[model samples]
Target: MNSPVVRLRGLTRSFEQGGVRIDVLRGVDLDINRGEIVALLGPSGSGKSTLLQAVGLLEGGFGGNIAISGTDAETLDASGRTELRRNHMGFVYQFHHLLPDFNAIENVVLPQLVAGRARATAEDRAAELLTALGLAQRLDHRPSQLSGGEQQRVAVARALANRPELVLADEPTGNLDEATSDRVFAEFLSLVRGEGSAALVATHNERLAARMDRVVRLHEGRLQHQGKADA
Candidate 1:
């Protein structure tokens, strides 16, 4: 766990809009160790999402090195990147993005099934995660029936369903009320820690960010340390 689960060195990303060049990430360097939870704090449009996209291997045109679990992302082709992502990464967004037709447990189970886990095994994993997240009684409830916090909890369960080595969350609790956000984010932190997986959570809430193991602020396309996180 001492070594980095994910490492970024000299990362850079830019875009051209209306003939004006905009740099989102510029020579950023970071390391996220196994079992560590890191908070990424920044206001909207601060390149937090772009940094996450690079780490998630969700896009191209990023220039730099992204090494995850000892594999360099630049070394993999499209299919290989997809395989790496499927095998090692999970994601949660500002929106829950649960499958409307599926129940809470099913939403979590589907990802495991896609990852080739046996149906029984997948169901068991889903049940364990949802139950731990306090959704035991609502396993069969659809997203439409769940409250906002419950829906986000299901999303957190789904993100951890495959036992991903790294979970990337972007504004995960942004949609909820402060009370709901605190509860949901606390559960998310607990679940991620329990699984022994590293996390990079992007959030604008200083209150929420302060709870992680470490805090990094994204400013002007670079990351600045904000000191150690809460214990």
Candidate 2:
């Protein structure tokens, strides 16, 4: 296996409210290799999303070492963190956060634009990704006009637009029906694998988690690796 694309050592996350400290993650040690599809599963508030956010650089108040693609994240400043996130990480949430006014293609290209790519170049790459995701015909459709699956597919395409080293998906298919969710998961896995990017998806759905290469349960506060399975 290749060196870890993502590594978390002695990771801890805590939130203080009204002088009370709530621990969300307690010393989480995880390593995700390139091209691996790993799922985080557990009951509500099991620190699944917290772990994702921590590793994805969405949260930084915690203590520990987070290394992505061989760079120690703890040593980076705000701008450095932002740069790493923009250049090496991709994120997909349960809700497709597509802009209401932008069409599918435009939505997918937004990230590339944020990364300083030319509009024409970003659009071209976005179009290609949308085409591969079976959203070619929906290119002109806005978020409101597209179906749930199509919107999520567009989000997936957006996640891949930058060819990120790691993709963090938080209940990405939660809003879709079973069939649609399965299709979306298939497309997501295929896309990540094809691009040799690692993915850590947070999900409550056992069936969906089973489809991943490895199932990891975030129990209490740490990640416990369950065995692999064939979906």
Candidate 3:
């Protein structure tokens, strides 16, 4: 197998509420290889989002080691972490946080622009991604002008704009209706696989989890690998 796109060891996180200690994650050790899609299964309040935040480098106060694309996250300062995220990671949230001010193609293009990609090249790539996601006709529409599913599709296009090695998504389809969720998720999986990027997607849906390359569940602050594609 290729080198892992993401690796975590002894990863833990805790919070204090009302002078009481709350442990969200407990020594999570995982490896996600290139071109693999791993479903993170858990119920609400089970620390699924917490784990994704830790892996995405969006959380401080996390304990233990996190390596992305082979670079040790512990060694990086804030700016370095930002750079790492910019160049190597893509993120999708439950809500489609597309910029309401920008059109679909422009929303996708902005990230690449931030990463120093040329305007023309970024536009072309954005167009390609949005088109692939079945939004060719909606490219000129703003987020507010589109339907929920359309907005989410644009969000997917934006997440993939940078061509990152690893994609981290948290409840990406949770907001949509069942039919829309299924269709958008299928398109999302196809796009992620086509881009050759590894993904760690957190979701409460078992049917969706079973469709991934592997299924891992978070329970009682620990990770349990349920199985893989062939297993």
TM-score per model over all chains: 0.97, 0.94, 0.97
Question: What C-alpha lDDT does candidate 3 achieve relative to the native structure?
Answer: 0.93
C-alpha lDDT score of every prediction, in listed order: 0.93, 0.89, 0.93
Candidate 2 backbone collisions, by pair:
none
The 10 consecutive residues of candidate 1 with the worst lDDT sum are 222-231
* Runs in model 1 lying further than 4 Å from the true structure: 229-231
lDDT of 1 at 142: 100
The CA root-mean-square deviation of candidate 2, after full C-alpha superposition on the true structure, stands at 1.7
Candidate 1 scores a C-alpha RMSD against the true structure in Å of: 1.5
Model 3: lowest-lDDT 10 consecutive positions = 222-231
lDDT of 2: 0.89
Candidate 2 stretches greater than 4 Å from native: 229-231
